[model samples]
Target chain A: MLYDVFISPFAEFEFMRRALIGSFALTIGAAPIGVFLMLRRMSLVGDAMAHAILPGAAVGYLISGLSLAAMTAGGLVAGCLVAILAGVVTRNTLLREDASLASFYIISLAAGVTLVSLRGSNIDLLHVLFGSVLALDDDTLLLLAWIATITLLVLAVMFRPLLLECVDPGFLRSVSRGGTVTHLVFLCLVVVNLVGGFHAMGTLLAVGMLMLPAIAARFWCAGVGPMIAAAAFIGALASISGLLVSYHAGLATGPTIILSAGVLYIFSLLVGPHGGLVRQWAPGRHLEA
Target chain B: MTFALRFSDLTLGYERHPAIHHLTGEVPAGDLLAVCGPNGAGKSTLLKGIVGILSPLDGTIERVGVGPREIAYLPQAADIDRSFPVTVYELVSTGLLREAGLFGRIGRGERTRIEDAIAAVGLTGFEGRSIGTLSGGQMQRMLFARLLLQDSPVILLDEPFTAIDDKTTSDLLGLIGRWHSEKRTVIAVLHDFEVVRKHFPRTLLLAREKVAWDATQNALNGENLLKARRMVEAFDTAAHACERAA
Candidate 1:
C-alpha cells in the first residue's frame, strides 16, 4: 500500500515525474518571494499580478499557437507594464497602490479572456485558465528550472535592502540611493515569479503556491529567516503530497496541489506554535525575564 | 566658522502648501542645536529638509561638510512598523550600512561594534528579541543604539523623546552629550522647554517661519514664544501660491 501511495505513481509514468519536478521548481523560487510579499502587506498584490499576466499570455497564444517561449515573454512584458503603470497611477492620483493594482488586474483579466476566446476553442481556454501540469514538456521543465535559479540568485543579492525596505524604508532612504532601485528590483522579482508560476498552475491558481505557504509560515516561525525557510519547506511538502494524491485518486493536478497547500494552511492556523489559535487561546505560564 | 548646513530661502511642504516657509539660515559645524516650536511648527519638516528626504519647494539646502551618507536620522518611533519580524541584532547591524554597503560582509569587528552599541543602550540581553516585543522606551533605546553604531558626523532626531520614560530619556540625552563633545553636529526637535534649556546650546525657534535663531536662553524668551504661536495661527491654509518669485 505504501509503495502504491508513494513510488508507483512516479515510477509508472514519465509525465507524473515531470509534473513533480516542475511544481517543485516553482515552489522553490516562489515561496520566499511570497513571504516577502506578505511582510510588505502586499499579499493580494501577488494574486493581482498573477491575473495581470493572463492577457499577455493570451496574446502570445493568439500569435504563436501555444508556444511556451512566446507566452512567457508576453506574460513578463504584460506583468511588468501593469505593475509599473499601477505604481505610476498610485503616485500621481488619489488611489492607493492596492486599489490601482486591483483596477488594472481586473481589466487585464477581462482583456485576456476576451483575447483567448477570440481565437481558440473552449478547450484551449480551459488549458490557459487551468494549466495541464500532467503534460509539462521538456522545454517548460527547463524554463521552470531557470526561473528558480534566477530568483534565488537575485534574492541573495537583494535580501538586505529588501528587508530594510520592509522594516524601515525611511531609514534605507536616508542611508543610500539604493532604496528606489531595491523596491523596483523586488517588484520585478514578483512579476518574474508570477509569470513563471502561471505556466505550471495557470493564471487563476498560480498565486496559490505563492501566498498560501507564506501565510501559513507566519504561524510557524518568529524571525523573517525562519519564516521564509518554513514557507519553502511547506511548499515542497504540499507539492509532493498533492502530486501523489492526485495521481492515486484521478484528480486534477494543479487544484489538488493548491488544495493540499490550503489544508496545510488551515492546520498551521489551528496548531502552529508561534501565533496559532491554540497558542493564543491557551497560556500555561509566564516565563521569567 | 564652517557651516555644517545652510538653508537658502528654503520652502518645504506637501501638495504645494508650504509647511516651512521661505527661511534662510546656516548651522555652524559642531553646534548642538535644539529646534523648539509649538505643534505644526515645521520642526520635523525642517529636519527632513536637512536630511534630504524632502526637496525644497523653492530654494536650496547645502550641506557644507557632510554628505548625505554621513547624516544619521532618528525618525519618530510612530513611523516604524513594529511588527516586522527582525531581531534587535539585525536592526542594530543595519547601522553599519555605510561601512558595509549592500552585499558586503559583516566582519568580526562589525559584529563587536553592534554588540557594543546594544550594550551601550542597555539592550545587551535583549539582542535575540524581535522588535515587536520591545516596549516604547526599549524601542527608543534600541533606535538610539542604532544611532550609536551609525557614528555619523551629523545626527538629526525628530521628536526622539516623546512618550519615553525618564530613565531612557536621560540615557539617550547622555549619548547625545557624548556626541556633542566628540564634535558631531546634533540637531533635535524638542517639546520640553526645560530639557532644551538644560541640554541644547543653540536654538532655532520656528513656527512655519523663523521666529528667533539664537542662543537657547534668548530664543526661548516670552515674546518670541508667543510670536511663534501667533505665526502658526496666522498661517494661511487655503491661500493661493506665494506671489514671491523663486
Candidate 2:
C-alpha cells in the first residue's frame, strides 16, 4: 500500500519523476519570493503579474510556436511592463497601486485570451492556460533549476536591504539611495519567478504556488527567516504529495500540486502556530496577562 | 559652534501650494530648538524639508557643517508599520548602515555599540523580541534605541511624545537632555506648551511663517501666541503660484 501510494509512482514512471523535480525546483525558487510578497502585502499584485504575462506568452507562442526561450522572454517583458506601469501610475496619478494594477491586469488577461484564440487551437490554449508539469522536458527542467539557483543566490545577497524595505522603507530611504534600486531588483525577481512558474504550472495557477505556501508558512512562524524556510518546506512537501495524487487519481498535474498547497494553507490557517484561529481562541491568549 | 542649518526664503509644500512659505532661519550647530505651532502651521513640513525627504518650492536650505548622513530624523508614530516581523536587535542594527554599507560585515565594535544603544534605551533583555510584540511605549523605546545607535550630529524629532505615557515621555526626555549636554543639535516639534516652557531653551513659534524665533519664554508670549493663531486662521487657502522677483 505504501509503495503504491508514495514509492511506485516515481519508481515506475519517468514522467512522475520529471514532474516531481520540476515542482521541487519551482518551490525552491518561488516560495521565498512569495514570502516577501505576503510581507509587503503584494500577494494580489503577484496574481496580477502572473496574468499579465499571459498575453506576452501568447505573442511568443504565435511568433515561435510554443518555444520555451521565446515564451519566457515574452512573459518576462510583459510582467515587467505591467509592474513598472503600475508603479508609474501610482506615482504620477491619483490611482492607488492596487487600482492601477487591477485595470492593467484585466486588459492584459483579455488581450492574452484574444491572442491565444487567434492562432492556437483549444488544446494549445488549454496547455498554455493550465501548464503541463507531467510533460516537462529536460530543457524546461534545467531552466527551472537554473532559475531556482539564481533566485536563492540573489535573495541571499539582497536579504538585508529587502528585509529593511519590507520592515521600514522610510528608514531605508534615509540611509541609502539603494532603496529604489532594491525595489526594482525585487520586482525583477518577482517577474523572473512568475515567468519560470508559468512554464511549470501555467500562468493561471503559477501565483498559487508562490502565494499559498508563503501565507501558510506565515501561520507557522513569527520570524522572517523561519517563515521563508517553512514556506519552502511546505512547498516541497505539497509538490511531492500533489504529484503522487495526480498520478494515482488521474487528475491534472499542475493544479493538483497547487491544490495540495492550498490544502496545506487551510490547515495552517486553522491550527498552525503563529496566529492560527485555534491559537487565537485558546485560553491565556495574551502572554503578558 | 558653526551654523548647522540656514533656511533662506524656503517654501515647502505639495503641488506648488506652500504649507510653509518664505521662512528664513538659522540653527546653530549645538542649539536645542523647539518648533511650536498651531494646526497646519507646517512644523512637520519644515522637518521633512530638513531631512531632504521634501524639496523646497523656492529658495535654498544650506547645511553649513553637517552632511546628509550626519542627520537623524524621527518621524511621527503614524509613519511606521509596527507589525512588520523584525526583532528589536535587527531594527536597531540598521542604524549602522552608514558605517557598514550594504554587504559589509558588522564588526565586534559595531555589535557592542548596538547593544549599548539598546541598553541606553532600556531594552536590554528585549533585544530578541519581535517589534510587533512591543507596546507603544516599548516600540518608541526601540526606535530611540535605533536613534541612539545613529549618533547623528543633528536630530529632527516630530512629536516624539505623542501617544506615549508620562513615564516613557520623561525617560525619553532625559535622553534628549543627554543629547543637549553632548552638544548635539536638536530640533523637535512639540505640542505641549508646558513641556516647551520647562525643557526647551529655544523656541521657533510658527504660523505658516515665522511668528517668533527667540528664547522659549519670549517666543511663547501671549501676544505672539495669539498672533500665531490669528495669522494661521487668516492665511489664504487658494494662494497663487509664488512669483520670484528677478
Backbone clash pairs for candidate 1 read: none
lDDT of 2 by residue, A1-289 (tens): 9878999999998988998898889999888999999999998878888888888888888888779998898898888888877777875689987998889878877987787688656536566688889889999999999989999999888888888888888887776767776777777788888888888789889998889999999999988889989999999999998998888899988999999999999999999978899878884645774
Error of 1 at A213 (Å): 1.5
Docking class of 2: medium
The C-alpha RMSD of each candidate to the native structure, in angstroms, is: 1.8, 2.2
Candidate 1 TM-score, C-alpha based: 0.96
lDDT string, candidate 1, B1-246, tens digits: 898998899999877888888989999999999998888889998988888878889999999767876799997654567889999999999898877876788989889999999999999899999999999899989999999999998999999999988999999999999999999999999999999999999999999989999999999999999998886444567798798764
Off by over 4 Å in 2: A111-123, A284-289, B233-237, B244-246
lDDT of each: 0.88, 0.87
Please report the candidate that would top DockQ against the real structure: 1
TM-score of each: 0.96, 0.94
- Going through the candidates in the order shown, the clash numbers are 0, 0
